[model samples]
Target: MKITFLGTGTSLGIPIIGSKHPVCLSKNSKDKRLRSSILIEKDQKNFLIDCGPDFRYQMLRSNHERLNAIFITHEHQDHIGGLDDVRPINFNMNQPIPIYGLRRVIENLKKRFFYIFSKNKKSNVSKISVYELDDYKNFFIVENYKIFPLLTWHGQLPILGFRIENFAYITDASHIPFQTIQRLKGINILVLNILRKEMKHSFPFMLSETLKITQQICPQKTYLTHISHTFGFHEEIEKQLPKDVYLAYDKLIIYE
Candidate 1:
């Protein structure tokens, strides 16, 4: 299995518009991030996790011709904004792309992209099939992968984190319930989200809290995602992290 970090920044990504923060102003390419997303490929099957606003560019850069499915973590625009851009894939495959998410998230997608869901839709709109996921109680099969949806919380909103075999991906989580943590145990690679070095009321994990959780789960390798410019330059943060953990950057690929 191979995993690609398509985009690693939080919503209003790094180098946020109109800001002059030094990290944002840095010349390093890693510092210039897009909204969070990832691509997982196993045995020629491609599964995308989140399709943020940068999805088009991320796809172009990766140059993958086919997408098997999309697994959404939540309904936030940063995570699902680029979903409409799946038209090219729909055109290539001649079928609607399957999107998996919670019932509420699926409902929100139907409301937000009503044209695509409507019977009177325009020809140009992307076609999608929604598969509602039941937290913990259900699992789905896609090609060679068996996916388990782990439930977590983003403030008051219930969101999903997915576990595929020994690899798991979780993002935008403020509090991961004990049940969810048990589901994550014994993973080979864990991708988690950390917004900054300090805590905020907005509900993303800070570096300190992330570290504590990372220690508890103890995945052989842990990659931090959904970063902000406030986390500091990529190179400096990389040096400070524990050897098994890393700050994910756009286009970074990991194999398991």
Candidate 2:
């Protein structure tokens, strides 16, 4: 299986608009990140996790030709903002893309993108089929591939993480249930989120919190995403992490 870090920054992304923060001003490409998202490939099937506002550019840069399905972690605008940008793929595939999310998230999308959901939509509009995921039920994207949805929390909002084979992808998660951690024990490769070195909000994990959880989950390797400028320069801060931990940057790819 292969995984691509399409984008690795937090909601506002790195180099937030109108800011002169040094990390944002840095010339290193690693310091310049788009909103957090990833693309996963297993066998010949492709799956996208979190299509943020930067989705179009991410896909173009990576030159990924096809996506079999989309999985949403939550209903936040940063994660779902690029839902409309799937039109080109829809046109190329000549079919509706399948997207999986929680019931509330599905409802949110229908309201936010009412035009796309409208019964009499234009022929040129993007097309997608929505699937509601039950927090307690595992589902399959295909006959051979099973996707296990691991429930997590973003403050008070319930969100989801996923386990496919020995690999897992999770982001924008604050509190992870004990059952979820039990399920994730000994994962091979984990893509988890860490907003910054310290926590200023209750909705996401900080470096310390994520690291503690990492130890608990015992993944062979952990790639941290959903970063912010305050997390420090990529090259320097990354060097400080444990041997198996890494700060994932935009466009980075890995295999498991």
Q: lDDT values of the candidates? A: 0.91, 0.91
lDDT (C-alpha) at residue 238 in model 1: 95
Candidate 2 segments exceeding 4 Å error: none
Instruction: Give the per-residue lDDT digits (tens) of candidate 2, residues 105-184.
Output: 99999999899999997657778899998755555554378889989999999999988989999999999899999889
Give lDDT tens digits, candidate 1, residues 154-253. Answer: 9999999999999999999999888888888899999999988875656989998888888888899999999989999999999999989999999899
- TM-score of each prediction: 0.97, 0.97
Cα distance off (Å), candidate 1, residue 33: 0.7
For every model shown, the clashing-pair count is 0, 0
Off by over 4 Å in 1: none
